[model samples]
Target: MATTPDDSSGQSTIDESASQVEILDADALADEPLPEDEAEPVDAVRPPGPSARQPAPLLPAMRPSSRPARSGDLLGYYLAEVRRYPLLDPEEEKELAIQYQDTGDPEAAQRLVTSNLRLVVKLAYQYHRQWANVLDLIQEGNVGLVEALSRYDPYRGIRFSSYAQYWIRAMILRFLMDNYRMVRLGSTRHGRKLFFQLQKERDHLIKQGIHPSTLALSKALNVPEQEVINVDQHLSAPAMSLDAPTSASGEGRPLNEVVGNDKAVNPEQDVARNELGEVFRAQLKTFETTLRDERERTIWHERLTASEPVSLTSLGKRYGVSKERIRQVEARMKRRLRDHLTRELGDEIPIYLEAPSD
Candidate 1:
């Protein structure tokens, strides 16, 4: 059985470090190869271990006695081959950890990693339902495992498996979140939190006979109710491509091909419209300067003319009142702006306001 550091101090340190894991998605991790460089030859990796001084006398058994007919069977080959390496005992594992940490011995580090290949496979299997292919998770897990080896402190007296598992899970969860759909879902911090905790919390509540409503999940995951709803909706949605057929039948046109085009534009009219838009915005700003009350000014700027208007409920909560009160304030501000714009610019100029609907 492979051994690891499991002292109380080490466990506490691991727990604290686990919480401090940076909120980096797979893309950020991918940008810089923080993990081992794949191009480095196994022997070329340094600082060279005792093998540098020892004479070379080894035979490789990686090639099969008889070549199999199957080709491009990478996963199958890995599954069959990984079983050949045996797990290390406690004494041997600690010695290797010390060797690698002290001298940066690639060979010692490789042994420590290979000894725990089974651990990665087992953990990756647990997340099989999350990802279509378990091998991807395994690959990510191995990266984490290698990273853990670089940081592994043999003096901590904690089991390396227990410590390394945290890194492995973090990597796998990030991969799952980043690749949740064709478009990345967990790009933001709160998004990642929801991706990691939403379903887990929902399942817990469900097991306890709770309905797991958006509000309930919001409190359970400590995320905004709207964020929870958005993430939940995204999680349940399937990815669709613009190039995909519009109908189930193969005869259907691609969605992008079937989309309607806008009417032909007149260059003079387009230029006039663009100029009018600038005038309208300038007039709105001039009108905003006339507002004396802070609440009215904020309502006009944030909810009336803004591109993405703040919701009445959100404003009400921020201002400590009912959404109805927010609507009333917004309605009054909009009415003033509209009347001012109509009198100043006449009906010829287009004035647009993004308002909440009833």
Candidate 2:
């Protein structure tokens, strides 16, 4: 059906639509409200630049210098102090000693004692070789030094070291006598004096190209003849080695009924049999070594025996790896044993035992 267009109404509708699209009324949009609270302002982000050059800060209460104090230097300082004081000076030492005796001036006494520490140390060195530990000797010597200082008499007309020698040696010998049960050495005063003097006398005799005779020693050191011989016996006895071969005859058994070829055959057989045993033993040892190195025996003992096998997953968890690694280790150990056997024997090596047929 053909219909004729209404030209006047069409032109009015088109014109109205164009006017509605073009014109947006500000009065209508003003009724719409905004959000309730205002948004916070964002910080301006700067681009990253070169790191700032700041010097490393010093530690709190740390020494500024790099050098450290040395032990030898400290020892030298102590030794120098000891060398200045000769154990005692009559007037000054007497005053210090009286302060200790009368008023109980422990501080004065400690000062006196500390100044003489190196003297104790020097004397201690003489006994160092006798004792197992230098520290033990030094400690004993210190005790001896203290006793000497306590019992010292100014009127004795003797040097401190000279008087202290008896006390020091007494303490050292007492310690040795108590400890060394192998032989009860130098317990008595006479024996103790002889112990030191005998050595010096013997050394002197040797230097003079004469044998160390008991009568000569008795005359020189004023000791009895029997004591010198006893000490000499202890020193001269040679120590025996515990590892020497045991045999009564001192050699091999004698052959009285020995013939020519038959007797020679026995020795040859012995050598061949021994060599064969050695070869097998060495191979067995090598096999055991390879098994141990691969940890095959250890794994069998730990896991497949009476002891329960730990979970592979648990082992993997501990090591931060997969359970497959644990399995691979077991497989590699097995492979290594077969490869080692093949290498040791030959490529065509046969199994000694095989499974029975059904």
Candidate 3:
């Protein structure tokens, strides 16, 4: 015979299944209000949602691999692989340093160097202005990077990047000192500093007419007054004249030609050889009418005529007047005639003044 269900056991089994069914029904009712037993205690703020369902516990993050991986698919493989391994973990880097130091592991050293290529590229940019060529500076900086790697010490407690800075700077500075023509320009520290400062100062001076005084330069460069003066003198020195004319435009007149020479000529020979006799004779006939006195009139006509002129002293002797007085009379008559002729003849006639003879 089938055993009759034990009454208590059957009831307890039914109660457990019913409880599970209730839980399932409640889970299915997504929008149902929370049970009173599981609900948050009444307060000013209400719970955000159903209280029986606690949030799932968060899992800790997995550590990312330092090495980048090559991705593959069922069909094909891509050419490029992102190498996350190039990024150094501090601990892994420390180990690499020890291995390189103790065992001379070239691989470890290579890892360190490849990891820092970006850094070398960065530092090279600082000095590229003076060198102008990026490739040249990069090559120069690679030497610096190698020197930095050779000298990097893990024991000093300072970071490798910090230690490498000094070596990098030393290498770059050596390259600059050797290759830069500006270094030859200024050997002394003061001179070197002033070389750049003086350029700016000179530009400012030229544009605005401001003089670069010794005090101003000394203050600007933090150099001595004397050094400023010496540098300025060198800077301001006039360029040499290459001994060539600035242009081929005209004959270069000498200083002697710019100045003049004065000398006398023989008055008698000059008068006899003169060519303006016809114009003078016409003007003289017109001139005689101005002289009121007969003696003055005769003296004027004979003495003041251009050809065969007599001296003022000879004319004065004939007129019984001092030479100065006769000369004055002759000047008055010539002025009157010049005015008369200029008004009548429209100034086209050339009137030459007779020389006052002794």
Candidate 4:
């Protein structure tokens, strides 16, 4: 006797029985198609579904969105992402720095950079009031951070943050000096100090109920009074747009159009000055060579033509002559030069000599 399995729940369910045997004909089984779910055993390997079998997309179907275009929007995103990277403690920083320094491992360098991005952001924020584009400042500071990491000395007793702060602030300040205004701030050591600390010093003075004049600032900061005045003017001058309309008539005449081009070279004046200079130089050379007295020649070349003319007393001491003797020699030499120049170049000599005053 034979018993067939029952088909319930759309699947085959075998039943146990004693003394029951099931038989199948090979021709009948081969003629009928097996149901897909039924043909595969519970444990048998099966091909993936149609969705999975389809080709993968060329690009990710759900990639991370691009950063927004507006600065304000991007700033929020940057702050949130930067916060995700926790600051590194001294030990952690030292280890990563050492790893990078020894093996030049980029991954270790990356960890060091990511961990300290918050520090860059913090320093960049301090410069926020001074600059309009905070994001650009942060980007520059990040470059500084990378440089600091590359040059970091793990054996140094100082912490990485303290060391990195200098570079970070330096890069940001340099960027500001180069780009924050149409006119660049001076880069001399004293100029840089004044540029960076003038405002702070001024504020401190004001808080103390002291006037923040150039003299006061110069004394407080130990910078030259003129430098203090120059930096103060740079800080106070408002940025003017060249494209802005100049008048209420709405004629579209920009300030650039109305403003005189101070940089424009005066060809006429330049040519005249060049000709007069050549003439004066040739006549002066003749006069210098004609001088029979070596002392007079020395005084003429050393004292008169020097950019910072040496004092008469110094010249006299140098030549072991009295100051009165040196003055007389200089006067005679000047008269000879004036006469020679007048004879060679006529009225034009006075113009060139007088031009210096202007």
TM-scores for candidates 1 onward, in order: 0.43, 0.32, 0.32, 0.40
Best by lDDT: 1
- When sorted by TM-score, best at the front, the candidate numbers are 1, 4, 2, 3
Over all chains combined, what TM-score does candidate 4 have? 0.40
Cα-based lDDT at residue 291, candidate 3 = 73
Cα lDDT tens digits, model 2, 1-358, are 0111233111111122222321122122222242345322211111111110111112101113223323323222222333433344556666775676566565555544544445455544444344434334444555554555565453534434444444444465555544433225434445555544565566667768988788888777787777677665543211111111111222211111100011122221332223222322333334545565434554433332212455667656666767777566655654654466445433221112111111
- Local lDDT at 345 for model 1: 40
| Candidate 4 local lDDT, 1-358, one digit each (tens) | 0111132111222222211211122122223343334211111111222232121221111112244423434454444444444456778888887887788776676667666666666566555556644555666676566556655677744456655555566576666666533225444557556654666567668869999888999999997888777667655311211222322243323322222111222332332223223323434555667887888767655555542346778878888988888887877776776677555433210211210010
| lDDT of model number 1 | 0.52
Question: Given candidate 4, what's the lDDT at residue 97?
Answer: 75
User: What residue pairs clash in candidate 3, if any at all?
Assistant: 66-84, 66-85, 67-85, 68-84
**What tens-digit string does per-residue lDDT give for candidate 3 at 244-269?**
11112322221111111111223322
Task: Score residue 85 of candidate 3 by CA lDDT.
Answer: 19
RMSD list, candidates in order = 24.8, 47.8, 46.8, 32.9
Worst 10 residues of 1 by lDDT: 53-62
Question: Over 4 Å off in model 3, which ranges?
Answer: 1-85, 185-358
Lowest-lDDT window of 10 residues in candidate 4? 349-358
> Evaluated with TM-score, which candidate comes out highest?
1
C-alpha RMSD of candidate 1: 24.8
Where model 2 places Cα greater than 4 Å from the true spot, the runs are 1-91, 155-162, 181-197, 200-210, 213-358
